[model samples]
Target: MTQINRRDFIKLTGASAALVAVPSVLKAEIGSAYEARVVVVGGGFAGATLAKYLCLWGDANIQVTMIDKNPNHVSCILSNLILNDRLNMNDITLPYTSLQDNYGVIVRQGLVTDVTGDDVKIVHLDDGDTITCDYVVLAPGIEFIDVPGLKEGAANNFDVVPHAWIAGPQTELLRDQLHSMQQGDTFVMTVPQSPYRCPPGPYERACVVADYIKRVNDGDGHVIVLDPHPEVTIEKETFEQAFNGIYKDIVNYVPNATLQSIEINPGEKIAKTTAGDYAGKVLNVIPTHKSGKIVEDLGLLPVGARFAPVDSASYESTIRPGIFIIGDANDSGQPKSGHMANSQAKVGADAIIRMIASKSSSVDFVHDPARLEKIRTNSACYSPITYDEASFLTAVFAYETTNNSMKLVQDSFASSNSPHWNKDNFEDMFIWSESLFSNSFT
Candidate 1:
């Protein structure tokens, strides 16, 4: 992967001038002549942020419409708190009402069935409705695949074992199960392979659940974290400190525990993995992830592909001409997290606006250095290691001219310093999440 460090980025793009000044330059032209019809599908961070920016940055001349299956987006950002009773479901639930009332975005609720077009695409909804637009931004978050051992016709069947990866009804189910754990009881959860949504998410969930059990159940029960990988994926030192230092007794760290199948017996759910057979009162099997079915159905992905490839600068599909894929669905070499999605949305929104202003395809827009120089994206998220303590991870990504893809800036990766989790970081976690929530939703 081609990359540029902070020092080299400054050498090439003049740091602040390239990242900051170009927005002001683009805003002047975006407000007047760009009368474009853009349709954004999915209401998660990427779609919501994209739509909000499109309306916020573009003037009345730009007409933006958003479509989602749900009336509101229940954020997976901090949904883990729901399990530990630190935060309620309502706290993380984001509504589209503000996008409609505050911004002049047309919010439509329906399932997108099909999208067909070349330059201008027509989006078909399950309700038998069609919307033709000048551009389409697809932000369908992710779809869970079937793990081995599940019964036939039971794929994504959360009734038996609540994955709860996507925050919604299943999240409540898992929350209830976690809350009901009594002394000496066990709670088991699995971590899928890398490139999973929210790299540190499974580890964070283990930490939070362990903390809750210890604090609530008088440190009797244990939380088993079964991981397929040999070690933690992200925030290595911090999570190691958490699992080994504070919550060691409460958390059982089982490495290289690959899920083979599921076994259900009398009043027990067992995860039969390569490590061993471990049973729990409640089992959350986060299956492998893939781009939502829409992207596959639209033939945007290569055969046997998991993520749709896109030009990182513009987030437009390399397979298709006009459709732009953002968030977890696209292969941008970025961690799949809400904050990352939100960051990509800004760059994508700006790219779309610029394309609309210039009447250029995303391929051309990504190639044009003058236009590409205006691109920059940063993704960061704070993980709550405990109820009142948290850890953070951050990275900067920029379009590299050599590779023509988004690459992590060398020496830009930063995490919580020594004693990674503390009270201040925990408090700042909310402030950070609130800022992201407001910027994307409100």
Candidate 2:
């Protein structure tokens, strides 16, 4: 992976000047001879952010059509709060109305069956609609693989052992289950291996559920966290303190525990794992993930890889040009979080705008030094230790020209030190999420 610290990117690129000046210049030329139509698939963080930026940075002449299976995006960012009753589903939901009304983006509700074409892009929707465009940005989030004995549509399937990872109907189901836990009832959840969506997500969910059980159930509730990884993947110290210190009595942390299969029995949840058999009242199994079906169907992913390989600078697929992959679907070597996806979308949107204005015919716009220099992305995640307290971690990545990749900046790497959890951080988490929600949706 090639990268530099965020400061280095700022110093080399004149970041502020270029970001502020270049968009206006491109916006000025949008209607003249540089008009372009761009189709964005998936209405998650990456696609929504890219569509919003494409319209904001590129003037009215640039047409952006945003497509998704759902009418709006239900954010996974703070979905854990739903389980604890701290937040409702509507609290994190974002409608495409803002993107359509505010940014002049055309929001369409449909599934993209196929993305094809070379010079001129072609997107086929499941509803028998085909859209031709100059470029296509795909940010379809993630898809889960079938675990043994737990095929998605089986009679006793995910609806019972809800993953609640995608933050939709499943989220509500899990939230209701957690809310219904009685005193002394056990709640069990599994964490998949790394490189999955949201590195710290499983840990956060464990913390939130544990917190809810203790406070709401009068400390009589039990929370079991089964991990497939050796240990906590991200924010180790903070979550360690959470599990071992505060909720030690109520929470059981099992490391090196690989989930073999799940057999859901009424009021008797059984998970067969390498570690041991765990029985609980509620079971949440987050199975392994792969690139969204759209990207996989397009053959954009390398063999045996869960994500599409792309140029970090422009987010253009290494195998196919003119089609860019962002968010959790692409292997950009960045943390697969909403914040990182939003950051990559900005760089991607800018690159597409520049390419359109330059009249580039080829899909290889990533080799341009000027384009690579301006790419910078930062990711921050705040994990709730309790209902009222939270801990934070942050890192920055910049495009490194020498190796042509994105790397984490050593200096920008920061996390809350000892005594990481605090009420102030909890407050900041909401503010941060609101900013991201607005940037991507409104």
Q: Which ten residues in a row have the lowest lDDT in candidate 2?
A: 12-21
List clashing residue pairs in candidate 2.
none
Pairs in clash, predicted candidate 1: none
RMSD to the hidden true structure, all candidates: 4.2, 3.9
Maximum-lDDT candidate: 2
lDDT of 1 by residue, 15-63 (tens): 2211312556778755567688999999999999889888877767789
Clashes of each: 0, 0
Let me know the TM-score candidate 2 reaches against the reference structure: 0.92
- Model 1 whole-model lDDT (C-alpha atoms): 0.82
List runs of model 1 lying over 4 Å from the truth: 1-22, 29-31, 149-155
Q: Give the least accurate 10-residue stretch of model 1, judged by summed lDDT.
A: 12-21
Residue lDDT tens for model 2, 1-442: 2143323433422322113125665466544457899999999998998998988888686899999999999999999988888988899889999999999999999999998788888899998999999899999999887777775433438878899999999999998898888999999989987789888889899989988888889889888999988888887888888889989998999999999988877678898999999999999999888889899899998888988999877888988888899999988888889888888888888788878877885546546766566667877777888889887777778889887788887777767665678887788787778777887888
Could you tell me the TM-score of candidate 1?
A: 0.93
User: Number of clashes in model 2?
Assistant: 0
